[model samples]
Target: MANRIRASFRKSARSPRAGDGKHRKDVLDSLQELRNSIEKLDDTVQRFTFYNLQMAALRVGIDLSLFSSLVESEKPLAVGRMLRYLASFGAIKETEKDTFTSTNISSTFALLGFQAAICHYANTALQRAFNTTQPAFFWLQTQPEKLALFQEYLTTNCAGMSTFLDAYPVREHPTALHPERVFFVDAIAFRNRYRDLAGRVVVQDLAPTLQHAIQHAGVEMMEQDFFQLQGIKGAKFCYFRNIFHDWPDNKARIILQNTIEAMAEDSIILVDDMVLLNAGVHWQAAQLDILTMTMLAARERTQEQWDQLLQSAELKATSIQTYTASLEDSVIEAAPV
Candidate 1:
């Protein structure tokens, strides 16, 4: 009888009751759901903090530029002296040594081509433009001041981009096996499109202007659509940076197909763009993707999406390499097979 009781006990221990099993599963499911919620909350807090810091830094930079150009000129001036100097320039009404009114600072900055200040005053304008409002494009096109300020901002900030491109070790890659020919193609044709308004803006004679520039750089000037590349039969390799993501999958496929057609059996195509990892998407890339969506109906892509697009274009992704620049933006080097 004791042996029979022992056997029954063992069996009961091995097999849980139905109610107990349901309760255990419920506990585990609750725990997992709680963990996922906590993780999402953490991500939200991190993103908010990052944006806050970026905005604060931008504000400081703009205020410094506006109040006293000398603050950024040769040396850092005392805040008191800077405020006094701004008052002399009629930028501020009555500047206190320790603190000045935000309104005064903002007004001065707006007049001085500070992007942060312009962004603050033109909040509605920016939101409209950046959020895909119908009137936004009109504002950007018709408002000369807005366009001027935007260009000034680009001129100041674009140096970092230029430096990154300059320092990129293009020569390290084996030139014998894969010679590189940099081709810059944009819708804007004439250099006058970039000149200041008061400058001598001549529109006539754009072809020679482009030819001269390319000849100076020892590059061929081809007015071919990137989506339909031709005469690239003999090229060893081709590279397109920040181009593919500007279009949707179908359009990007067309560009990729053209690139693939241009490649020889052993040739490579390097695409420099974002490779959004599964771990965490970078904030800058995400925000830029939003802006692109608003303006051009384009977006950023992940590695898997890129693979799918390449395969759809009848091309293969051989490898992908990621690198972080000094700035927040990361660069992805993808090769085509």
Candidate 2:
């Protein structure tokens, strides 16, 4: 079966390109079918052997400095048998009998392999391998390029999705009238979305993140640690977007408690996050859940779990306004009980 699949791939590689995207999709579908077959095998250990083999190859390649040496070499060095093995998988380009050149894929692997190695050696706790003791944000402070990439992701992440404003009645809320009391966390996207709305939006984060936000005008950027007490007291709205999921319930409770202390009787906390279903979760949400778990030992919550978390923090969810149905992304509106 594997031989047949390999033959199919060889045939497709030689085939003439079609005008439309159909040909490309057909190739992708065939590849996916092969992957699906591997995953569907009943022997779980054997199924995982494919991934183990790939990882072993990666480890061996790195240990021998195969990718870097090839990428930096002025002339192709004498290739090893391992080079031919990797070349078969398109990791490098085979030139002649025992020579190879680095491809774009191999070059990228060479560059990123350093970053991966750094992370791997720095920390290892369950699946959270980024750093020990410090949270993700703090750990990122040491990595400027990674921190920028993370901030960029947060800023443009809401491009096509239905924003919290579309689902939550922000305009009708009493807080809309008093913008001074609206405290927005991770203000990059939020400030742009609510620009026309009344209020001096105070964006809070660690000192490093606030530095980025400070360059932008209109919104007030404040250095804040959410784990500590929220600086501004009795705000009309204390909004957090995609923040809670980075923490487990214990750590999340501390953040909520701090926010609660700064809230007025009529104040609301808008938690913009995915409210996953109990069953048949969307693939995107499930992927994010796994990511959070790996990154911070956290998990995305179901509606019931959200309710329980809020209740533990002495807050009640007033409404769950789902703007994006496909990903179950919603603005969980809650207030002090």
Give the per-residue lDDT digits (tens) of candidate 2, residues 172-248.
76544565555454455666777776666777888777666645686677788999999988766788888999899
Q: What is the lDDT for 207 in model 1?
A: 37
- Which parts of model 1 have CA positions greater than 4 angstroms off? 1-158, 161-174, 177-215, 325-337
Give the poorly placed runs of model 2, Cα more than 4 Å off.
1-133, 175-197
- Model 1 per-residue lDDT at 280: 34
Top model by TM-score, which number?
2
**Model 1 lDDT-worst window of ten:** 196-205
RMSD of 1: 23.8
RMSD of each: 23.8, 15.1
